[model samples]
Target: MSYDLLLTGAEQGDVAVRDGLIAAVGPGLPRDARQVVDVSGRLVAPGLIDLHTHVGPGYWSIDPDPIAWFSGVTTWVDAGSAGAYTWGGLRRVATESAVRVPALLNISAVGLAGRTGENRDLANCDTALAIDTIQANRDLFHGIKVRIDAEVVGVNGVEPLRRGLAAAEACKVPVMVHIGAAPPAVDEVLDLLRPGDIVTHCASGIASPLGPAVRSAAERGVLLDLGHGSGGFAFDVLEAQLDAGLRPHTVSTDLHARSVFGPVFDLPTTMAKLLAVGVPLADVLTAVTKNPADALGLPGGTLTVGAPADLAIFEVRAEQFSVTDAHRQTRTSPIRLVNEATYVGGRLLSPRLPAPPAPWVPLTRAQHAALTRRERHIRDLLATPLVDVDGLAEQFPRTKPRSS
Candidate 1:
């Protein structure tokens, strides 16, 4: 094909890009005119899209471009970094900075910041304000973000959720609710969520669980996204949910300054962890690319002709890696991998890195006790051998009995 530029290689390749869309693809092309890339021994795929991230660096105190472009994540959705009150500021600083950062306005006025129990105020979620903010910033704000955690919302129950949904309906958009242990069941949140709406942090601690809830959500056509942040991802919960045929609609890093140190190093690392956990490479890519794009109602990732030339190249290496979440639960799994580089519109954004170091920190007495309690509860569920699905046995294989 007569193309403007191309990347000639077997494992990875680029295409002719005009303006911002991909014009042609496949190895070999003109040596002059525009530019040429050589991707030799790496698998090339569409640019990673993180459906959930707190990109508000100023107020949310999370770095914006820390991992977005460098970690192969071309686009990200800021999950509740701002609300009606701070939406304008977030747009000016965070969203318009360097990468693509669509926002999910928090139902609470101050967003996930302010105080711990800010969402419990009830008055923070002025439906009118939420609707107005969403309408005013229609292009930037795509959905409502309501965190339905017991600790985050205290005794507010589903008031924040209700407000979020009401605002979403008014704005003609979906609501993304953060689900974990909470008052109004995850099922309740799923029941309220529509087909286009999103449920983030779907699989968290075992106390609240995620399998049954995810099954229900899938049946209801609600989208479940892996908001794998520091504290929001539980290995046991994800393994269980996936085994039960409850597949996530998206795989997001939920990347923040706090979660980016080691455990949740970057989006590529997070994706590799999921791959190690048994999610197929194609499925994982779909979750991060097409699925999230569809959920966010954006058009970017994909190698199909006429699409954007955004891409990521990765090399899966044979190495052992330890994955850790916010709760300090560590899962040491073999088959570690990392990103090689990233491209946006046929332009290389950032090169990838080598395998990351371990991220587990020494637990204190109180923290260790808490982690023990959490692990024991998860074990209780795992002990009763699942009879319904043999898939569970394969996904979360254990040679030794889980700790009691």
Candidate 2:
């Protein structure tokens, strides 16, 4: 049968799409499609599912489509950027985004309107409210999120997490907890997580969750997420976790307004950082694609027939690339996954320029200059004529002055 689109010559074999789903994927699929793209020497994998990100109406939120088109991240889970009170705004953003955006509703009703302290006011961590919100918006909210940090939770300690878990239990959804610097010890937070719960920033340098509690949590089926946000990841911490047989179950860039520019540029870059740390390419890909999908119970992580045709094509360049973690420390990766094209539901995603960073977001001078240079370049390109006079074809040619 003729397909709607066919992608040939990829490492994973030819992929055929029909009705916005994968029709077939195998060696030398028949070139029977309305549109056939020869993607020789490229690696075509399932569109990446970023398990954690902020692309909602909040302090940290950024437009996901501009990054999604080139970065191959078709699914962006807005991790706790919205709570019950602010869910409507986030829902609107999710509805309008070209990429899929499932979210983890914050336990606090205030949400992330500011950088932190969503859970500081214990009054906002209403379990009943959270449960009701999840019940009402099950289509958009997949789970619950609670930040267990010193500054975020304040004197409340793990009370917010407890409430989040209570809500999650009621809804039968998992809870993804963000861990950071602790006033309440890390163990206090880790001990309470139930099976299937996620511990984002599991290898945080600040929290340094390299303890028996963390190991026990993993044994009990709590998933670890490499939420490499502005200050979540540390090379030393991750390496230690690997040594201790506590590898992250999933890797996600907690991509937000603050971390989008550096450290956690995009999902592929975050994957490359794992590669630099000695994780196999297959494992890295699984973490970004399959593991994340499973973690959140979202779709589009495989090329199987009938799955959503969300895929990413990459030119895997074999070279030493210097990759950095949230900290300034850097490591060398032997390969780089450079995305050439991205597709969502069999439709090619159009290129979109990112909007300028929010004024409040801090940027290094170099980053600031780079953004300026990029804007100027785009302006120049658009300002130039599409084609010279010689390249134009005359649709209405005058013939002998109309024989007058």
Candidate 3:
């Protein structure tokens, strides 16, 4: 075959990636391939996209970036680590790395600091702070990230969401809200979200369960994301939602230190779990690739010749594997397969990869110079007086008086 690379396998049939693109895909290859590898038991598919992941400074236990290289995720969106107060450093870290990191600016200025004293005061959610942050580092930031779960928001309820919507509106982008176990009900949160904004952890396993209300939201064009994390996804809720025709528009692993084992081993493992739940293989691929690509406005999830050669090769096996939800309930099935390797722009990476660097190494001088410029602009906005925030308050929903 006259191909640069050739993969022959039962699942793959015959596939070739050449000149950093999928050059050929059929039953046979040309005789002049520069490299040919037999993959008889492995499956071939597009590299994964994780729309929700917790690898960030807040998840201080782990390195925020390189989770993609370790988990077979080619593209990942860091779900809110730095809001207005700290977005500069996070953006700087992302720009200095080779990993592709798109971020959802957290609604809370302090970001995800878990439980008591964690929820930054509502006043800190300055619409001006958010707008200026977005304007200053618009290239790195996308949308707003609000953790609406009860444990994360406490007595404040959906007030944080209101602020997030305001910030998203101010920045002219979508807001991705974390749902499931939120008070005032998921319905209330859904009501506040406009079409095109996102609801993640849609299959949340706890108190504020998902139901027909979610289906209604889906019908109204709200993006439902299955971001199965350590405490979000519930099998019962997910099954019920699916039964009600509220299929998740995107499948993601809200991968973190706590969830990246057995049940949520990696992004591919999460995909396999969704497949076992009656989602077709092609549909699963779409959830992780095309859907997220459209959501994030990125490219390279298809086999279109001339696109970047980012791909994942897997071995769909009959070996038994167990999948567990947030509550530790097991769902063992015998059809899941593991990723064999991943390729980014034609560079293949083994699945048994080690963990990425930690503590976020300092940026190079060139990178430091580039990041400093953006940081200064955001800091300047934060220094602006409260009088300059009237435009933001207008975006907040006006509280209506109760009828007598």
What is the TM-score of each predicted model, taking all chains together? Answer: 0.80, 0.97, 0.78
Candidate with best lDDT: 2
TM-score, candidate number 3 = 0.78
| lDDT (Cα atoms) of all candidates against the true structure | 0.72, 0.94, 0.72
Candidate 3, residues 257-361: lDDT per residue as tens digits?
556543465777787677656778788889988898788677767766666677777777777777777777767555775676677767775433335323343
List pairs with backbone clashes in candidate 3: 1-30, 1-31, 1-32, 43-314
RMSD in Å for all candidates? 15.9, 1.3, 20.3
Off by over 4 Å in 2: 389-391, 400-404
Please give, for residues 67-141, the per-residue lDDT of candidate 2 as tens digits.
999999999999999999999999999999999999999999989999989898988999999999999999999
| Tens digits of per-residue lDDT for model 1, 276-346 | 67888788889989988888787786877898777776676678777776566666546655667676666
Of 2 and 3, the candidate ahead on lDDT is: 2
Clashing pairs in 2: none
Q: What lDDT, from 0 to 1, does candidate 1 have?
A: 0.72
- Which candidate has the top score in TM-score? 2
